[model samples]
Target chain A: MKPEEHQRRFENTDTLINEPIMAVDITRYCDWLAIMFYYGAAHLVDKHYAMRKRPFHPDNHSQRVDESRRLKRGNVVYKEFLLLYNAGLNARYEPIFYDQEDVKELKESYDAIKSILLTA
Target chain B: MESTLALSQSYKGLIADSILNILPYTLAKDQSNLLETPWGRHMGDGSYYTYNLLESVRQSIVDIPWWTIGESNNMSQDTCETELLDRLINGLLAFATTEKVIISQREESIAFWVVSSALDIMTQKKYCYFFADIVDKEFDTEYIFDFRIVSPSNRDLKRIPTDAQVYVRR
Candidate 1:
């Protein structure tokens, strides 16, 4: 809830999405993919909330992404958030393996949002 | 200012593309009215509209299981799309009107799934909407899709009928 705590969590998630995600390969790593994707997204949202000095609540993630986009009133970032949110949902809920092509798509979405986050 | 406007347009286009991606195309019977291929997953062998784009979405949400851990056969890339088309036809019978409805899907998860009641619209020659699920999160809050989505070119909007009217259900 503290601002420093939120900052640490944000750094931690930024590392989670970037570093740990690279460990996943074409063979079998979907469970981690889905969890980290959702966490990465949720933490980005938490970063938004933390900027406003609000505690993070971990529910209705789609709502959070949309709301945060509205909060910042940014354009390209909204689509990035949408990609992350939707991709996260697919990764989390589905019981399928994310192939090379899938990871490529995830990487595109991940890169878009992560770049925006790092600069922010 | 120009950069801001361009990004705004880009966001809206992506929004529309996402909406169009998960949707089914109403088969214009006899193939007399339209071209065959808008690309494989966009329109099918001229008979079926490309409903299952790379196995991420389905023609009928009825086939999409409520639980994530269902059987694996449907998840395969090679899963026959005709199976999804068949489910849509069977599912259409529940409605009184025959208008076949479809949704757009470019993303991994679409919160809004529009089911057309399109047969009745075409047959009776009218626009109609029902049960905009606003209050209940357990159900659908998908807004009544304007004719913009169903018209010929998803981008051009050249042939959309002018007499569209919404008949909101009580």
Candidate 2:
């Protein structure tokens, strides 16, 4: 598959994986999801830039860095995929609160990233 | 002079609003007037008094609204990344060349690195400016403002500073 096509497939898969983690009563799962979402997004950007041989827009890059820092400082930045990296470390795991508002925020973040990818 | 005053005033409001939106709560009572520039008069309590004066005229023209809008294209994640990489490469290439390539990829790369490094330090310092929460008390609570006014003549990304102004409670 072409690079763009490959990226789209990965995005679709990532979104699917992210869906269950955002549901209510899955708070414990959120830390993991947030980590995955961040790294996945970063990797996506990295791959795109490496293939295209261009630097990311400053605004987008700044935003990514910001998000990355948020996860890291929250004490959840981790390597393992399943474990709540920061949450596990801090022992602040709470029951998931997957409501329409939370879901909407997730969707918005996903949509923004997707839109940037599609257009770039 | 009147226009400049108005523009400056408008920008101050924009900056304050932007901060409020991103910050967890309202700015502290003392730090509320942090946006006032030296040229603008400080009217105690976060308000400003404006005076219009025409300085030596160099050149002036009213902005015209262009009706033409560019067509939208569907971009993919990779494409966006590629675009960013290309810009970086271009800037780098400019830096490597003589005769002023005018793009300065090297400078752009350097700036990016600087900002990234600063961000790392800030993170270590527990100073959250962009995505920091208000509840966590570690570093002195201060609002750092950094924005660029991009114009056609100065499109080079390197010139824009990452940490514009670090504001503390006055």
RMSD of each predicted structure: 20.6, 19.5
Question: Candidate 1: which docking quality band?
Answer: incorrect
Per-residue lDDT of candidate 1, residues B1-170 (tens digit):
23422332344334334434443343322255666435444443343334344333433332422211111112221223324322332333235543333322222222222223332112111221121111111212231111211211222222222211111111
| DockQ for the candidates, in order | 0.01, 0.02
- Top model by DockQ, which number? 2
lDDT of 2 by residue, B66-151 (tens): 11011011112244443443343233223211111111112113112212111111121222221133212221222111111111
Runs of candidate 1 with Cα error greater than 4 angstroms are A18-21, A24-27, A53-59, A71-73, B1-111, B114-170
What is the per-residue lDDT of model 2 for residues A1-120, given as tens digits with 9 covering 90 to 100? 345655765676587555764552454454444444444555555445445444433254333333232232222221111112221211222322323433343434544554555455
Best by TM-score: 1
- Please list, in the order the candidates appear, how each scores on TM-score for chain B only: 0.20, 0.14
**TM-score of each candidate structure, all chains considered together:** 0.39, 0.27
